[model samples]
Target: MNRPAPVELCHKNMRFLITHNPTDSTLNSFIEVLKRYGVTTVVRVCDSTYDKAPLEKDGITVVDWPFDDGAPPPNKLVDDWLTLLKKKFQEDPGCCVAVHCVAGLGRAPVLVALALIESGMKYEDAIQLIRQKRRGAINSKQLTYLEKYRSKQRLRFKDPHTHKNKCCIM
Candidate 1:
């Protein structure tokens, strides 16, 4: 029997869900839901209009990531993002992680895809998850990155080694 494609989880499980365009109402709603589910970490890209008080009101930790402007985040920035997610994962191994940007099609999906990639998800699977969860579009740079990302992986599905560049270490 053939297994069906994994449905991208935008709901829970320390899973990374991308919400491309989150209005104030939507953001508040999501925060409330996450609070109910006990999700602690919420990484957001820079926004002058964003108010952190809502998250604080709900006791969720919000990390401001200014590198999500539809550009391929720098390697150092990506490293920092991974480090933050790692720390969050370690702090509460039972909580869900959701990363979001303006439209979820650019920085959010790319970083989340990288997270899935690091979490042992195959390239196509990771990208598919992002597309399914976020939107069908991941921008040009992200798509290019994914194609190259999958190509670098060993066909055997072994873990990737520490990368040396911003693109992909596979």
Candidate 2:
């Protein structure tokens, strides 16, 4: 099967593997590729659902956070996704998060860009970085949202014992 290779984007401790949806014929190969990147989680932002058993069998967590095609994600969805990522990275610093929409060009890149921006990267820089790695990423509407995006305080993982912020993307 001919599938586009996953694009790897990294900023400090955060790493994201961006790719298109895998068909049944290519799923095995996809898993192998994800393993090579030490991916511990796969986040799907597309409308369809795939069998999660195979990935879970390999100890990779799969999360489905579907949104419309060519549209930016809702504010709550973005916040929740950042929280999920923050917790995952805090638990495993070396783990990579694989994110995909149908083509890995629109929704997936937008989410990754938002994460980068929240992690102290400028909006334009984030867009440039993703476009460099995954060509044709981020549609115009999505770009508009990103252009106006103001990074909120960094997502923090709190230390349970001390009630202090233990980990932050920034």
Candidate 3:
């Protein structure tokens, strides 16, 4: 059965708040929020499976934290993004990382939670903080990714059980 789509979740700081399949019009909403908050850069997750995203000319320093639609970050992209996030944490400790995807449910939150983990936060703590910071912390799929990213399976193939037809299957 088809699941409900993901929804946009906004927050005051860029503390990992991203959109769920934002439209061209919705992108304007994002831009407006970023402008109001004086945000300069964003760490967007390009879909490794479909390769869809906003134009490259958006001028945002796009970081390809690759992840498939239903899967987690690929091995190569996972290590690459971890290194990037490590550097960013050292340089921009307090800055926010906006992880956007077709939907906030899948790749976006997974990357955000991973960023939290890289920022020296515990896995469970990271998930909870994300939940508090961004009301829509993650969906079942993203949580599955987080679970794997927390365990030994991070950066590997996704868990079959976690990749279920959940409440939101973005």
- Best model per lDDT: 2
TM-score winner between candidates 2 and 3: 2
lDDT of each residue in 74-156, candidate 3, tens digit only: 76776776666545544554454556666565677677667656544567886786566456557776676676664332222
In candidate 2 the C-alpha lDDT for residue 115 amounts to 87
**Local lDDT at 12 for model 2:** 71
In order, candidate lDDTs are 0.62, 0.86, 0.55
Score every model by TM-score: 0.70, 0.87, 0.60
The list of candidate 2 runs beyond 4 A from truth reads 1-3, 155-170
Give the C-alpha lDDT of model 2.
0.86
The per-prediction CA RMSD against the true structure, in angstroms, equals: 9.5, 5.1, 13.6
Q: On a 0 to 100 scale, what is the lDDT of residue 149 in model 3? A: 63
- Per-residue lDDT, model 2, residue 83, is 91
Clashing pairs in 3: 20-103, 20-104, 21-102
Arrange candidates, best lDDT first: 2, 1, 3
Give per-residue CA lDDT, model 2, range 6-108, as digits (tens): 9999887788999998876778988999999999889989975467789999998888899999998998889889998888878876479999998899999
Best prediction by TM-score: 2
Q: Over all chains combined, what TM-score does candidate 1 have?
A: 0.70
Comparing 1 with 2 on lDDT, the higher-scoring candidate is 2
Clashing pairs in 2: none
Whole-model lDDT, candidate 1?
0.62
